[model samples]
Target: MRIQSTKQLPSLNELKEILSQRFSGQYSVKTFGAGRKSILVGKSTLIGAEISIHKNEVSIASSPPSVFGGILMTLGMTELALFIFPFFFKHKSGYRTLEREIGLFLQHQYC
Candidate 1:
């Protein structure tokens, strides 16, 4: 859920700019509130990441993909499903892969 690096982290704005440059062309990226949070939408998945200062580390909270998430939201049941079977979603390799890529991107960029 959080990525940490020894590399000097950029300011929030800079970090967001870096991320935007990486993801904007590839995903439908929606940035909110001055580089604080961003949502990146892909074909069957949408991921949200927030860059925040935690202690001396710049921590990023990244959300995973949801297949058919629109339908679930329309029916108002994604929350219920997540509440009941959270691991069901967290276990997806796609999510893991995305998370890894994001982490690596930050690590490589800053390091």
Candidate 2:
């Protein structure tokens, strides 16, 4: 997805269309400074998300309370981070580097 900078936020219909195309589901988009936040477009979805670019780091959070709250929270946050990393971070290698790093880390387990 190509992201363009805009001083004014897009209308909900516009936002919804953009997000639905990007996420391939019912979704809505919001912007905060250099960040883009999104939410699932159904009632009581509870899939909250936020993304921000600060210094050289991209930060993202998606906290949705579920029956297994902690696990869902962690998964949401990780998904948000992965989705936004390429956009916010300026590294030449892009998110593929981050994905590989994470994969290697996951490959080694203490347990």
Candidate 3:
């Protein structure tokens, strides 16, 4: 996701501070470059997001873990056969929910 804000954004550290305070325990933030950082939100560490803030634009890149990946990591063969369908649906929907939440938060703060 990419957002263009009419107002200038705060410095990276300041932005991290703001997000940390707003999100509290829901997310973890770490700066890795001059204007780039990564965040892991929600209960699972399987999904990660990279955020880049430049002047008035913020870009977010996230690669959600696949349903197959989740199953392989968290379930056994018996449970997989019994629960694959619901797991697939739930995993996908959870990602969208998280994305929307983050987008709305950023929009409210910077857009």
Candidate 1 per-residue lDDT, tens place, 1-110, comes to 56566666666556656777788776544444454444443424444344465544655555433436534444445556646365445545655566666767767776
lDDT values for all models:
0.54, 0.37, 0.63
Off by over 4 Å in 3: 33-43, 64-89
- Top-TM-score candidate index: 3
Tens-digit lDDT string for candidate 3 (1-111): 788997778877787788778878876666654434544344354454556676688877664334444455465346565766565555665566667777778888887
Worst 10 residues of 3 by lDDT: 34-43
Candidate 2 deviant stretches above 4 angstroms? 1-21, 32-44, 63-111
By TM-score, rank the candidates, best first: 3, 1, 2
The full ranking of all candidates by lDDT, starting with the best, is 3, 1, 2
Which portions of model 1 miss their true places by more than 4 Å?
32-45, 64-91
Give model 1's TM-score versus the native structure: 0.55
Assess candidate 1 and give its lDDT: 0.54
How does candidate 2 fare on TM-score? Answer: 0.27
lDDT of 3: 0.63
